[model samples]
Target: MDQVNIEHTPPAVVEYLALRQIAGLSPMSREGAEIGLPNSLFAVCLREEDMLVGMGRVIGDGGCFFQVVDIAVHPDEQGKGYGKLIMSEIMKYLKENVPARALVSLLADVPADRLYAPFGFEYTSPKSEGMWWRQGE
Candidate 1:
């Protein structure tokens, strides 16, 4: 495989939504992407030629709390270490920007959690659970 280009840049709304679909992730609305991407504390985009193939972002208050989100890679590009490359860039940002006691978290979808373990993520399990508020529930 040829070298993949990874950069500290966020994807546009169209590319962001498309990558989510390709990666089997939940869809984000156009307005959501428009508002959200700019607010990211750190973001990385992987490209092969002119195509956006992978992306990840860190979002949260600048201090005390941060969450790793939107980690996705194109289906055709899966198993190629792009996810780890994305995470490494995000982790680098966290290591430099977040304070020692600040909380960093992510909602790992099943097996993907394994990819994060080496970066020091652990299950919050019985001590504390991860939760989200749905639109109606």
Candidate 2:
């Protein structure tokens, strides 16, 4: 996968949201309609000739913390460093805008944590924990 173009589009924010809905792992979907919208979070996608190959984003409170969510690369594009690309882009944004020691977090899914670790994302184990609020009963 050579020559991937990463675009930070304001109007295309919905792409990341839609992809998350497809991935079906984030709290946004479980949180229901009032909570999740097209642009509630900041998003970025990797495109190779107009096709969305990968994406990730930072969501949550601007003052206290942020969650790195929606990290996904299309099935056909996986194992090609696309995941790292997405992580790098998202981390870059956080580094530039977030204040020092502002607690940037992400819920790693199994082996995916390997990619995130090198980007300075540590497991919140021993000192802390990670949990979620699921929807419905």
Candidate 3:
């Protein structure tokens, strides 16, 4: 594995879609990406020589509530610490920017919960559960 460069730049919609599909994440429509990405409070992208191999973003109302989302890395590039790289940058942003007592959350996908534990993310079940409502559903 070559050296990967992580940048505080959001991925373009095309690269975002490609990374999500390759990472086995659900797809997001182009219009959705266009509207949502620009609203990110902070975003990081990992590049290996010019390829967008990994990305993550923090989105929310930008003060009291924030969510860590869109964490993805190319399948071929997994296990190379790219996810950690992305998370580290995102965490740094959160720690520096978000106020104390602010609520930060993320929907950890099964096994990926382990990835977030070190960053102070814990299960919010039993007392409260994570839920979402799809647009047409």
Candidate 4:
């Protein structure tokens, strides 16, 4: 982990999309990335020697609601606690910035969802199911 740096900065557009693809997350269009990345409420970028290895972001209406999104760690870099590191940074930002009663949420994918539990995320199912829809569907 030499030269590992946790930057409170959004990754560049190309690296951002590449990391998502390499991490097996859904592919995002370039135009979408251009529009969305700048709107992040908070973002963390993990770099080793200045190369992007992992990242996470928070996005939502400023005060009332928030969601964690785009949590991706490169496959070659998995199992190194980078996910936890990213989440810790995000939690710190939320604690300091969001309103006390703001609704925070994330749509976790399993096994990886376990990573979020230690950070106090819990299942919202039964009470309400998570759902999604893409454009042109």
Which one wins on lDDT?
Answer: 4
Indicate the residue-level lDDT of 64 in model 4: 97
Regions more than 4 Å wrong, model 2: 10-41
List lDDT for all candidates, in order.
0.91, 0.72, 0.89, 0.92
CA lDDT for candidate 2 = 0.72
Error of 2 at 49 (Å): 1.7
Candidate 4 lDDT over residue span 54-135, tens digit each: 9999999989999999999999888888999999999999999999889999988877999999999889879998899898
Off by over 4 Å in 3: none
Which regions in candidate 1 have their CA more than 4 angstroms from the true location?
A: none
The C-alpha RMSD of each candidate to the native structure, in angstroms, is 1.5, 3.2, 1.2, 1.1
Assess candidate 1 and give its TM-score to the true structure: 0.95
Please provide TM-scores, in order, for all candidate models, with all chains considered together.
0.95, 0.79, 0.96, 0.96
Q: Which pairs of residues collide in model 3?
A: none
Clashes of each: 0, 0, 0, 0
Worst 10 residues of 1 by lDDT: 128-137
**Model 1 global lDDT (CA atoms, 0 to 1):** 0.91
For residues 9-105, what per-residue lDDT tens digits would candidate 1 score against the true structure? 7888899999998899987788878999999999999999989989999999989999999999898988989889999999989999999799999
Better of 2 and 3 by lDDT: 3
